[model samples]
Target: MSARRLTLLVAGAFCLGACSSLNPFSSSNTKIPALKPLTAVAKTAEVWRGRVGSAGRFVFQPAVFGDAVFAAAADGTVVKLQAGRNVWKSSVDMPISGGVGSNGRLVVVGSPKGDVLALDAESGKMKWRVSVNAEILAAPVVSDGMVVVRSADSRLFGLDPADGKRRWVYQRALPALSLRSSAGVVQEGNAVFAGFPGGKLVAVNAINGSLMWEGAVAVPRGATELERIADITSLPVLGSRAACAVAYQGRIACFDLANGSTLWARDMSSSRGLDQDGRHVFVTDEKGSVHALDLSTGSSAWKQDQLAGRGAGRPRVVREYVVVGDVEGYIHVLRKDDGSLVGRLRAESSPILADIQLSGGDVVVQTQDGSVYALGVQ
Candidate 1:
């Protein structure tokens, strides 16, 4: 069998096992809570709703440029929407497993087959395409005239934004067993950051892909693979001087952005990502509870367990509220000051696995059924 085929088979087996062990619908000891009817407190209006394509079991978040939004579906359909209307629609002609990263002029996406595609953001015309030779499950980030992508096999590639040519590639050895998910990549100035399976976070030059610093967000500990799983599956949240990251079965830590020093860390576990504002950090724990911690001290501010076992997505902080979605298609709005549930809206009947995007004064959500909705809260 070919190497690609073998990788796919292994991924399939891992997915099956993960579903049996982690799926809230299974007859396991854990029970996913039925969503309670929300008593609306804040006013929410849907700006526009449209379909891109089905995400199936994959995660795909829409990207918001200046006045437009770019979204890609699992079937390779990419759409650009302006003022809630379709501006242009195109396809990569291959299964797009990750993407919708844009910088107004150029939009980039990735496929499970390792194909990285760049398109004109305004015209939806294909500009260039290249292969990274590994599965890209996270959205590609474009910044500093470079496009950064992370593959499932722990390789990071920096490509030229103009022609999709390889600029630099960084590879790290993988553990014998690790989670299939990734922390994705984030760019700040000339530095690009990514989290690895061993709970390590690395910063590199976006232009040359040279290592800047590497720090451990969580340290693996235990006897079994499941017990020792400390993968940083969420995108690292950057603050003014520090970047915070979470690890499954490991601690959430804040590291100094300049020197990779551990600023603060606390015993916390999460499968999803985190969000931070000026004062506090918000995280969704493994059991589906969301906690607010002091950004400077890593002390717990509040914990909201109302959505426990509901398969919550990552948190996105808007002006005064933090927004999160669930596997059941409900968008929960919580007051950032105290972690209280303030408002809830249902986008679709399907599960929402992707991170919610806060665009301008609106929130953009993409459901598993391939529907994208822009909503405004008042």
Candidate 2:
């Protein structure tokens, strides 16, 4: 072959490899197994299914407030549903990139334009709007009379629920290259917990924004930027005595909720988050394996690997099963005690990206195409 033609061929090969590594749909690295047809073993039925505009790649889940559930779409449609009926539907006139946070009295959402808008929960009327100057990819959380928001730039802001006035701002310098996803902030009593790019988890006083404690769940150690990208992108699962977090290329560790002391650490990695029940914590790892760890010690209870390389979301602990959604719109229910696949269902033809939301006795799933389904098991 000619020298120039050979060089061009080599460059094209490298480009294709890089593209496949980054694309979630690409099965070049690992072949995604065909979904096994499930025979109906559990009585599963859809309680309600609805669509807000197309969500595209943005992650938006429903937030429950008393008798109402609030959800938003990428095209700016927000709806309030109760008892399988839409109470009200409205639009913010701008793309909503984050949120569904509500406290019954006020509902909050964030935009790509850095605007945080609050609406009256009763009538879907705009209460207040404020700017934060950065894109918000995670949902805003309302607690302790404050609405907490985390910007994509790693700045955490506390705003007054009454008028969207800024209460406090916490800023941290971010690494040059880091994971852009966040599990948002978890609030408990007076403490607000959030994860950062460097595998760090911080606890702040929700009332005053003062640092309560900071702990490292995982430490970055590799040479390349991709290898050293240890980001704590998942929501920390809070238990009675401790809180646990997982890092993308790092470890899963539990910290004392009262003082942020490391309780136990395990060398596990997951881009998605973790969930905990009374006895165990469930996490979906980067390879699409789901693990159940003991709540007291971080010991492994069980691990399931049938969905590896299938792009699974975080696991949600339901009544007696752990439910997870995958890229092919399949919902798999595994027995919590043994991690055995017991039931399965399909929500839509699109990918299910957001974590499953549990309401009452039903689980709510949101797809990439903006379909929301309330599934119940009988």
Per-model lDDT: 0.85, 0.82
Q: Which one wins on TM-score?
A: 1
Q: What's model 1's lDDT at 266? A: 91
- What are the models' TM-scores? 0.94, 0.91
Model 2: per-residue lDDT, tens digit, 262-369?
Answer: 988989988877899889989999888999999888899999998777788899988888889888898888888999887888867788877788887888877878
lDDT of 2 at 271: 81
- What lDDT does model 1 reach? 0.85
Model 1 lDDT per residue over 95-188, tens place: 9988878888899999988999999987999999999998888889987489998887878999999898999998887665667773578899
Query: Candidate 1, clashing residue pairs?
Result: none
